[model samples]
Target: MAHTKASNTPSPRTIIPTPVNSTADFAAQQRNMSADNASQGSGVKLKKEIGLLDGVAIIVGVIVGAGIFVSPKGVLLYSGSIGQSLIVWILCGILSMVGALCYAELGTMIPKSGGDYAYINVAFGPLPAFLYLWVALLVIIPTGNAITALTFAQYLLQPFWPSCDAPVEAVQLLAAALTSLLTVINCYNVRWVTRVTDVFTGTKIFALLVIVAVGIWYLCAGHTDHWNEPMRGTFTAPGLIALAFYNGLFSYAGWNYLNFVTEELKDPYRNLPRAICISMPVVTLIYVITNVAYFTVLTPEEILSSDAVAVTFGDKMLGFMSWLMPFFVACSTFGSLNGSIFASSRLFFVGARNGHLPAAISLINVHCLTPVPSLIFLCVITLILLFIKDVYTLINYVSYVEALFTTLSVSGLLWLRHTQPKTERPIRVSLALPIIFLITCLFLVISSVFQSPIEVGIGTAIIISGIPVYYLTIHRPVEWLRNLSQSFNLWCSKFFICMPNQEKFD
Candidate 1:
């Protein structure tokens, strides 16, 4: 790398130490990282600003977004009874914890930023990894962000149209605007993003706390009629139970989000598992109790009929102060969208760095010290997805597809264990835990086809579509596509004032 002889130039930003090699023992890796942390201002890598608290906040913020606030009614709707819905919620939390535990081992063992992509790439190989990335880039992460933004818009606008649903156009327009704004904020600085996450996580928790308190008061005041026959309408079909879990698990989706930025996290060995340990159970408790609170005021029929469950809960319970529910929901979802965007951009950035994605995606903004191109690319896709007739039309299939990939990821952990038994795990989970979670996730994916065949069919089609893309762009690239990727990569680099990840200032 060369630089002009200009006195005004700032020193080249230092990249932090790369994650320890997966084969190294945990004790040695920790010492290496501590030594690396002692030296600052050296590398071109992302800054390590996400401490343990930040990790917990990111996971909670992302998981507690729109799914909980807007459509948790789906859980009750599919489960067919209060008792069953509550059971599914608890089971979903356990399942997420189990899966997140498996990921902790992967995060510490592999210690890379792309979560499933990194693990699968190491254990399975690049082709399957690319497919996961392809589907995620298309179906999972951005779709989740779009749903969060849409819900944020709906709640923020609901206060304005007290008598009717907010106009779809207004909701979507605001959703796009919010998405764009967050993408810009994310590009500017990592700390700025984490600060927004921490602040909003607090407000969001307070909102849920109020709901739970009010509901508890209602329960204490002898409003037990809704639970008089809690098991009265429980569904017995396996498929229906699986659908209920899907609804419950969507809110639990980001439990593994912290694994996505293992490199950016302050101390992956200590903080990764610690954050998971702290965040998952707390979120599960909040979600389950919060649902219990909702039932205290809203009957089964009301929950099934209402579009915005939290807002409706507010209207029924908060009276004149109902506006606060929508306000806080907007805050919760805005944070969720920011967390998802921050994590997923790093996924693509790492993927590009590893040669699975376009090189331009790996470029770092010289001025912003962030992956500007990936953030912008994600924002553009999210905006396009946001404008579709129903931004969350794919929500029907999104969780199903997510379950499929996570299953694949955990299976990779099992594979790594058998293949490389000597590798030291920083936070080893019980072998039986991954086996149980694996079986459960497999059941969810299989049962989803029976629950909604057409939607699952579309998701399967999307996954299959990636096979050819892998061939054309990666496994064996053709002349034209490779050239196009090169030309586009150069244009992006120049226009963004960016340099490749491995390059540093002189």
Candidate 2:
């Protein structure tokens, strides 16, 4: 006979004496234990190996992607002068800073990953949060990554191609490969991802500084004709300025990507806000100086006429060194793609953990300690999007929805404050911050509605498409579907060698 402990913990029997009958029996027992853990609602969790500099890298890398190089023309097109262009850049920076402050407070209070998804889930409810996730899954995050990768491919391949327009097949194939590369990188340990981001972030910053330095040299040597005519073709129409600001906002889009990985950041309460505070202002200054540099080297007419502003600026200013611009743009866009995969995968992981998505996506590789399933899922979705032509048109259809959800997210700050007054806040801003950001977001959405009603309608319809999904999953989930989801999740865990652990949410 064998004896067993008499404690409260459950046991297989009153008297436990049997050993494993075979290795197969041991493997079966392990699988059963994992399945039980999964049924108990436990999941894999993220490790916090990131720091302040890592956070800043994510923000700067994602925010500075290819946009600053190309968008000068768009800004100058609408602003009609260097002064107005600079103003738009600075104002968008301030708006981003205020928005970051609000997010910092929320990130600390909740102290979770998922960024806006976590904040909105707590402040509003699951329905609205699910809707946000639906759009993110189908549109916002994937399209954003696809656009960045396509841009990267376009710039990287432009040198070899004879025409100004890159060959469409080459661009698409290379973009897909780029996405696959970054996805594989992120599926490993977190440090690998941040390390890549930091190095590329440094590279892009150095490239920008080179441009700024050359511009300063030109200005010092008296290339000042454009400086004298700062407001010549100014279009101060409400619609035009709104549109200009809208474009500027797109360039400033990735400031909040850092917040998405809050769980992975060391000392997040202090570092999250500090990273945002540092990166936003620095990027703002870079944008202003870089635009000034562009205008210093290229006249407004040349700037407008050129298809690629930074390339033109390089050709005009850098002389023999003009060959470096395309490489720099490619690096910048590659970093953005890597950082986007890093951040957006976390959103999917968190959403999956919370039952908003299939639990398989929440799996973390035991050896790698990364969200393998989520990363792979995002890779497939983004790769599918890579096949779609006209990335800008696809992005435009969802821009309104992106702005609307961001407004809803920032508004969560106010809603949470009123509802959860006692929640601890490590970096609270004045009420005016979120209030002001929400107003700006609302103006953008409303103005877009008036300006592009049809596109806005399409975006709204895409979001509304999630309702039936919501009803099927949350409101009226089927037993067979749940069983199938659980079985699939178990299979993935076993295949990936995942070790199930209890996930914590604040």
Candidate 3:
């Protein structure tokens, strides 16, 4: 029975009673049950229901989010010309594909949840992994959810605010509600999550196709002027181009996260790679076509001036159907929230399972077959973020950190080839894939740092701050920390109602 490893179940090879004493004891006790170990009878497992299509939906659903609708303006602002903007989008697609292929290799190799956390833990060590986890929990997941939720709220309520400037408080409230709704939805089961993802993915894709179709029809009907002066209004500075890449890359962010739930995917070794290969190209083509549709109607000035580029395009092109654009954009953002909540919860579950976080965070609802505790935690954090003023500004801080960790995670391909060459790699990528992705990631990080040193410093400091916390909880394992974890687990079990109580790892 070659199954995915469960977060709560220890490997049968090592039996241990509850309440382990020291950090070393806990670390040694928590087995890294890879695919090989599971075949030897590790009852610990997650239900594998995600098929090829579901896996592809998760990738596509998360990647094609509010960024695509909003990022084009930033790209045009720096791209210096319409042609350069399109070129940047294409280059980003290529860059994302390279990174996705590299991760496909790593995902099959590890076949575990936690995405970057799993890869970094294996290649470098636990400390670096812990730092990544720290940033992920605190920044990456919450900020992303908040940003998407806000985007969703804006679009959903855009009709009321015809001027497109909705009240900040009203938007945050709706965003909070949206985050809570998705979190609750994800608490059901993997099947439900995938079903919702499939429907939403289809809806958004259909919407994009509608846009593409109409754009082509409109172009055929005489919207040739925008294409004629493609280079009319473009900006051409190095810093600006670099910033454009950042925006474009952000739109392509979620392509790597399908690996976060690898344990839940059916025949992960084969399906994971297939899903990545299929989703990235589809998303790229859709994105390119959608941009073409936008340029078909809106000029560079129109695009740069509008807060919601998609809505503006709709207003210009669609007769009475312009009203539908906000609804479609809301659907896209909501789907993105679903995907983010689903993936981020797995990181918390994996972090707790690996003994880097509170043991309570690992609780899974056996009946529901979901990481309930982790999902709730993410929802709560996202809700908190909704209250913060200028949450979108926080994106740059996490973006810098995201690029750094992604670079490190992709480099694992090179490291593991040297260190664990004999380890079964069902899908190995070319050496150049990781190299190219790393160079691209490094360039993004360096450019962003030069442009926004303060934000980069904040991100770096947050990662470094994890070092002492890591020492306190993981390295030293203080008695107070043990008590705190135990209390937290107890509180979570009691309050969350549905979350199952697993034996504490500590």
Candidate 4:
């Protein structure tokens, strides 16, 4: 086991030290790592157990979750037509691919675990990075988990409530309970989590592929009625289109999830881009065709009326096996929620390691080698958010904040291109790609203000609220406050059976 270095203040960050052995960094003076063998510069000791396939499973599992099973309804509603919704799905996939490629450069170059927070910290500095962390840890991460959990609970409860909506209290309680269960599982074992991810990834993909096959067969059996007016009712307003994208892009949210655990991925330089290449196109295709499948079997009114589209599709198509659809969808969402919890905890852990969050959150369990404290904190917040009733509203808040920070991240990437011209980039993307993605994403963030002013304003306030938190928490603390923080850290260490993360034990 590694001995943790105790500190009251956050670590200084001219560079985050990633140790090769006991004490020496992978690089003498650097935050950026190069090539397949190099580890991320996160300093905290986490294993590289994730292979290329595991990486693919992680991205696919997380992205293809409740969104695909759930978001088509929102896409169809906001897009105002089956045709427009399909276009949004395709465009969102392309947009995700572009942004992911930009992140590939950032991941291979910096190879850090915190994702946007790490990239922003290196390119801009801690303040901007901390602000991203603030919105993410509070609003984005928990709400996403809450949404997934709620979706899972809804589907799991569907067999009982075959005709009507599940009770609100029942849904919320089940969601909270499920979130807690996954958190405990995550805190127990890292390898077990990946194994669960791999298995569930296959299950969800199979479920989606089943839908696509059935739809294709239905399409081939001379059922072309739904294609007569594809563009009929498409929304022309930019705000509505962007809102549709919020649903579409929300389904594609986990494309960059692998970057959050860069340190845990084996041969990141080779595996990261390879996983993205293999996973993105496949996920995009499944999403589009699955929506096509939905329209093929069910009318737009039917889709709009149902809460769980996939379940309804199964019910209409699967006959006596209708129960199996809910079962498969339930398993799919369980895996997705698991993946979200896994990746999000790592983000908070890395943030704490950099001193942007509570010092206790940086600690790794001596026995399990997972960041138990961070996982628990994430579970607590997610459970709290599960109390919020509107799942779609959570998705919008997630999308709104998601677009804002991702735009900032690409902006930071461009800044790095100007500032660190000579940095070794194992995977450098074209400058034009990030620029185009940045502009397009910025538009999505702005367009939301016109459509959902209250949500956008609330997102803005959440981000701005981080300013005071940064100043008070990370920047300056009075003597008594510092002492109180020390005592809190001590209690957390003793209770959680953890110590601060170190580069190496020896």
Off by over 4 Å in 3: 1-44, 232-236, 494-506
lDDT of 2 by residue, 1-506 (tens): 13356765332212121244443553465566556555755434577898988889999999998889887788878787888988998999999988889889988998888988988899899989999999999989998999899889988998897466888889999999999998988987788999999999998998899899999999999879888978888888766787888889889998888888888899998899999999999999999999889988888889889877888888887788887898899999999889999999989988988899988797677556788889999999999988876656877888888889889989888988998898889888998889999999998889898878888998999999999999887778888887677677766666665543345554
Q: Please name the candidate that would achieve the greatest lDDT relative to the true structure.
A: 1
lDDT of 4 by residue, 258-305 (tens): 999998899999999999999999999888899999999999999999
> Candidate 1, residues 1-506: lDDT per residue as tens digits?
34456754334452322333232332253345334434543535577889999999999988888778877898999899999899999999999988888999999999888999999899899988998999889878788788888888988898789888999899999999999999999999998999999999998999999999999999999999998898898899999889888889888988888888888899899999899889999999999999999887899999999988888999888989989988998999998999999998989988998888888898887666789999998999899898888656776766687888899999999999999999999888999999999999989999988889999998888989999988988889998887778777766755776656543311
lDDT measured at residue 281 in model 2 versus the true structure, 0 to 100: 96
The positional error of residue 94 in candidate 2, measured at the CA in angstroms, is: 0.5
Selected candidate, larger lDDT, 2 vs 4 = 2
RMSD of 4: 7.2
Model 3, 267-310: lDDT tens digits are: 98889889988999999998888898888878888998988788
lDDT rank order:
1, 2, 4, 3
TM-score, cand. 1: 0.91
For residue 285, model 2's alpha carbon misses the true position, in angstroms, by 0.6
Model 3 global lDDT (CA atoms, 0 to 1) = 0.82
Off by over 4 Å in 4: 1-44, 388-395, 504-506
Residue clash pairs of candidate 2: none
Enumerate residue pairs that collide in model 4: 2-505
